[model samples]
Target: MSDISSFGATAKGLAKNPIGIIALFIVLIYGFAALTLGFNPKLEFWERVPLVWFLVLFPVAVLALFGWLVSQHHEKLYAPSDFRTDDIFLKKSQISEKREADFQASNEELDRKILEIVNRLSKEQLEPEKIAKQVAKEVKDATTFIVDGRAFLGRPDAVFTYPIAAFETLGALTDEVYFKLSKSVRPFQYGTTWVLRNESTGDVIRTLRMLTATPPGQPLTDIRTLREVGIHPGNTLVVEPPPC
Candidate 1:
């Protein structure tokens, strides 16, 4: 956010910076000299300077080609990321950073919740017999699964189903988290960390240590399956916002 601002604000900020001023001065001088030499190409100085040297120094045609090349590749190989000037995204880039920050905050909240849950399950709730009583009230199956998506102040929850048998390494099989969240009603905000919780026991089952943990872009196999992470069919999972 330190550098995020409109074009006019950016220009004003740069104007106040000494480094920017020096860069601007250099560019202006180069541009002026190039323009002067460009229109007076037939001047007597041309007799002493090689045409190839002049082209290398100026390179107006080269710059035009560069523009054409960018035009051909834009949106395919490249895209505007400017917070304010991106027309391709319909100015969505302007809010892209804010959304990223919001997602980060959401993930932090989930992590906090996960830590609390872990402490409760391991430290506070020391009685395994008490935990058994709680589970006795709720039946758990080892096969079918239900995951409720929670985005925290975002869109409605998206429910997804998964078969325990298919709970293989998401990093190597199917689309990482999608193989689990694929049945969701809405496409979740990508790149958020995910934490799985057992609704019946209020137990924190799994947590994505990083964004790459469940996503397919980077191949990282999970050593533990859902069952290994304390997931069960009767244990309806609440997927908190942020992950893959």
Candidate 2:
């Protein structure tokens, strides 16, 4: 009875995500079809050929259709408006120049903030609150940094560079801080020792080095959920360089 209840809860949890529901539906359909084909000893040669063909082709077609639907949904959700034409007529050179200028300015500002945090860490007296404030002020986008030698930064309007599952896991670590930051930011690389500090107390909560490509069913120590990390509210998270 207890085992059945636990299985029911697991199924219910999986059903909550549309992707999971779709995947489970596909698996059940395929499994049922396979079982039916295998058990039906009365199937004629012609019938078996067509049935086998249908079974093979149907799932591929369904998966392709699902992919197309997801792509269309993402474009609609995140694509910029085509209605705006103010800069449509601008020359390519002019647009490039403007973008480069903005990128440089943003990069400079980020560098300054990183340096400030480094200096603060070097001090004999470490104030977690001050460190957190400095980081919160500078890190407006939490999705731009490199993790474990892989770049997670995507286009300005992109939902994510990696799988949504990975992002959800990372978000679990960052908590509310992920929501506060912009979804878009300039991409940058970092060393292996990068740590996420509590914005208010400056205590190390997570180490980004643990964010490697973890296999399914494996635990990601660096990207563990907030509950797993045991972080409480009022703790703003900031990415920092390796300790000196």
Candidates' lDDT values, in order?
Answer: 0.50, 0.49
Q: Model 2 Cα displacement at 124 (Å)?
A: 79
Relative to the unseen true structure, what is the Cα RMSD of model 2? 21.5
Model 2: how far residue 2 lies from native, Å: 10
The TM-score of predicted model 2 comes to 0.29
- Write one digit per residue (lDDT tens) for candidate 2, span 21-62: 666677678877888789999989987897798798988899
lDDT of 1 by residue, 1-244 (tens): 5554664575565566444544455556666666666677566765536644654665675467557755753323333432235553553433344334544554565466545555566766568786554444332232456777655324465666665445443222224455555555233323343445568887755434343455424433344445445664545767664433
Positional deviation of residue 223's Cα in model 1 after best superposition, in angstroms? 3.0
Poorest lDDT segment (10 consecutive residues) of candidate 1:
74-83
For model 1, the stretches where C-alpha displacement exceeds 4 angstroms are 1-142, 150-157, 170-176, 179-192, 207-219, 241-244
Worst 10 residues of 2 by lDDT: 184-193
TM-scores for candidates 1 onward, in order: 0.29, 0.29
